[model samples]
Target: MSHTLDTYRLLGRSGLRVSPLALGAATFGTEWGWGAEQDEARKLFDLYVERGGNFIDTAGTYTNGTSERLLGRFARDRRESLVLATKYTTLRRPGDPNSGGPHRKSLFASVEASLRQLNTDYLDLLYLHVWDFTTPVEEILRGMDDLVRQGKVLYVAISNAPAWQVSRMQAIADLRGWSPLVALEIEYNLIERAGERDLIPMAREMGLGVIPYSPLAGGVLTGKYSRADLTATPTGTDDGTRKRFNLGVGAVTARALEIAEVVKEVATELGRTPAQVGLAWTLRNPGVTAPIIGARTPAQLEDNLGALEVDFTARQLARLDEAGAIRLGFPHDMLASDRMRAETRGDLKIEARQ
Candidate 1:
């Protein structure tokens, strides 16, 4: 079924309602070297909020903090009606060792900075931006719970962390009566389905809504890059900055190009743009609560918002899945094997419990 921007969904086990497509503020400022300036960013913001979009996502350190500053200004009037989500843990200063991490100090300091930058006394949602693998889970959970108790943060979430670690943290929160993580953000798209093996499933079982970032695979699924562009040198312009970033992160490889071909084919079949097709594919996942749309321009934002109207036929979805499938390694593959299934069921017509 097709949804609108106002078709709100419950975020994980929480009662908070959020739009299916979140408005990402990562591209809200030109400080990143490739993003919309203040006026353009405001236009993007207005376009989204006018369309009944209420989930606005950003980070305290995004675009060197310009993103949050701009959002704070634009959202000043309607902040109460919007679910403003920002993250912590990315370094706020270059040389400060305590400026980042999931520890208590970093958590409190980052929340304070974010509240100030966002021009708000309380944050609707706060996420641990990255997992440093050094801080104890207890420290992170306790700190987040403390913020919730203090009313500095309403909800806590995580991003870019291992699946096992997230699950463990959730279990700890339940045991300790802390504020549970309501969302999980990860780089997920047709070209990057590694999250499917564990992260997606983990979120489903642990009650964390999976919010995918880079749902377009850094524009690789937009059908803009050709095989010839793979070898072209990246320049310093805004467009070149994206290409350079994509190349540096290995986003525009031969395999990714193959996946883009399938996406374009599906988009053609559906009379939609490749960007819409790609974003729609992410929305189809039952485990996914929302996919962050990082469009830098009003036109791009409008195109991305069309993803809500896209519905894929079974055949089209299967083709897209085949083009970018990943190996679910180890126990997942082993358990799904026919022989293992037969051994477990003994040829009985077993109906799996939903």
Candidate 2:
């Protein structure tokens, strides 16, 4: 049997609605150790599409562009029906100066190259992969707007940028009436809630869709690493990701398992898995539009997709929220206080928590 989501969700706060969950085909080549081969990648893609996932996300840096190439072939026949999104500005080449960064020239060339690789005339969504500190805000916005005018890009978005930078970029776009970032992508998971600081509020106010990548906290949420101290070297195996990603278990790895215990108990109560709880946590955040699901196999994709079946009660949510919550700092923390709420609502009646 296959798992299916209940309904589609709008991207960001935009009118464009897509599958509540999306497929991330970054593991489509031999670049990464555990990456699924083209044939297996195709199967995973098919599984996702069959389960009603219409949105797909990828980037140029993935497997030296083979990921996009494979996706291009698999998506060809159904290009018009799928919400295809890709990113640029990671690395131009081995040592090319203009090869990477969010510079206008780099962004422009990346889009054109991506268009050729994907075999699509226009991308449903295009992301400025990661922020390059040197690139000017206006240059990025104008270059992207030019693509929209040229019919090469439908929607412009961003990934791995700070809240202040996004805010400034949007203000510039507003002044120029250019195509702005409609979405923001970050590495968010039960082990990583840093985006709640400025990113979430910025997204909420700007009407931007928040699509977090690495929602599994680099596989800690899977509960496999819990059996090991993980203080040793990351295991080396064709199916192993840690060694290849060059990361050992993090300091938060223990915390991830502690949360996993609650997740397992909850899953036992609901007959689900910890992986489902991790995914649901990301999906349930208020400003979250979608969490990109990366899978190296059809079975993994199917399992992650089952996250849609996991639900949390108010009490359950409170438990996980407090467990993983990060400090928002300064004004944000001040604004969330009961004292502030009372003052902000002076003479108005409001409901209190139980």
Best candidate according to lDDT: 1
Tens digit of per-residue lDDT, candidate 1, span 1-354: 438989898999899999999999998887767788899999999999999999999999999999999999999999899999999998899899899988999999999999989999999999999999999999999999999999999999999999999999999999999999999999999999999999999999999999999999988899989999778666556562366778766778899999999999999988999999999999877779999998978999999999998988888988998999999999999999999988897779967656
Residue pairs with backbone atoms closer than 3 Å in model 2 (clashes): 12-209, 92-99
Give candidate 1's root-mean-square deviation (CA, Å): 1.3
How far residue 112's Cα lies from its native spot in candidate 1, in Å, is 0.4
- Kindly report which residue pairs in candidate 1 clash with one another: none
**Deviation in Å, model 1, residue 141 alpha carbon:** 0.3
Regions of candidate 1 where Cα sits further than 4 Å from its true position: 235-241, 348-350
Give each prediction's root-mean-square deviation over alpha carbons. Answer: 1.3, 3.1
Cα TM-score per model: 0.97, 0.92
Angstrom error at residue 149, model 1: 0.6
